[model samples]
Target: MEREHFSRQFDAELNDIREKLLEMGGKVELMIANALLALVERNTELAVQTIAFDHEINRLEMEIDEKCLEVLARRQPAARDLRFITLALKIVTDLERIGDQCANIAKRVKELNLEPALKPYIDLPRMAQAASTMVKEALDAFVRGDENLAIKVCQDDQVVDDLNEQIQRELLTFMMSDPSAITRAMRINYISKCLERIADHATNVAEMVIFMVKGKDIRHTIA
Candidate 1:
């Protein structure tokens, strides 16, 4: 009876950790969305709020890490359980970096808010949407153990990459055509780069998810 009770408690603890990780990922996804929304609507207030949200993400990271560590020390989980705990640690790092990227985007949005928008933000919103989707799907895949979805996330990164290159080229043309637009164009380019980095982080999460599910290291092996 004592062993059974202990097993149940251990399972509950694992679930709690998983839940906390999901919470962190959700905040990151929201951060990406809010950052882009601020850029599109020219809402500096929203950008500031998005930047502030990062503190919560940081707190969650530490909280989740502590939980995972406690489980490791107390339970001495092995096999899949060990993988889940270790991967959880690595995933929180990626998620936290994604939050940082969103904050970076928010900061750039504030700076760009001071100037007239360089263009109508044609591909940027699309890029942000794609990157944001990657983040959401990556987290979902992780929690759900959906290997196919994780693979799809890995495949989807190319779309973000292409959009980034296209944005850079267009901005370059803007800089070449009008010296006055250079500053705004460069800021916009930086945001594009941030989104790209976020997508990269999402890909990292997806890759780790693949490893968690199949016990295989697919990093740098996919595409």
Candidate 2:
């Protein structure tokens, strides 16, 4: 029954990690949504609050990491269990970075609020929605052990990238057409960069899901 006892403990640890990941995912989603809302609504107060929540995301990341390490040390899980722990570690890192990106967007929103509106709220919010959707899909893929869903997330990254590029080009045109628009355009540029980073983090989550499922590192492959 020794093996059975170890299996039970291992499963408990894994379940705990999964729950924490879900919690982290929920918080990050809220942060992203709030950050975007802060910009759209020009609410500096909400932006600041979103920035503050980032610290909690960092703390959750560390806690999840510590638990994963504890499981590794105590159980020495092999095969799929090992993959689960490894993928969890990678995923937490990506999620934490996504949190930072959300904070960065909030910071940009604060800066942008000091100036008059550059243009109508259009592409940036659309890009944010797509990025947030990708993050949620990637997390759902992990939860359901669905490689197809993970691959879907990976495929969606290109749309975010395209949106980023479009935002960049449009901002460039704004700056070029009206020299006075440079300052506001620069803030939009930074916001697009933040969205781009979020998409990258989503891609990282997809890669981890693939690794967890296939036990092969496809991180280097361009798709």
lDDT of 2 at 114: 95
Q: Which pairs of residues collide in model 2? A: none
For residue 138, what is the lDDT in candidate 1?
A: 92
Q: What tens digits encode model 2's per-residue C-alpha lDDT throughout 1-223?
A: 9989978877888999999999999899999999999999999999999999999999999999999999999888888988888888989999999999999999999999999998888988999999999999899889778899999999999999999999999989999999999988998899899988998899889878887888787877957
| Model 2 lDDT-worst window of ten | 214-223
TM-score of 1: 0.97
Candidate 2 global lDDT: 0.91
Per-candidate clashes, comma-separated: 0, 0
lDDT of 2 at 30: 94
Q: Which candidate leads in lDDT?
A: 1
Give me the displacement of residue 89 in model 1, in angstroms.
0.2
Model 1 residue runs over 4 Å out of place are none
lDDT of 1 at 187: 89
lDDT of each: 0.92, 0.91
Q: Tell me the tens digit of each residue's lDDT in model 1 across 1-223.
A: 9999999999999999989998898889889889999999999999999999999999999999999999999999999999989988998999999999999999999999998877787799999999999998998998788899999999999999999999999999999999999889988999999999999998998999899898988887876
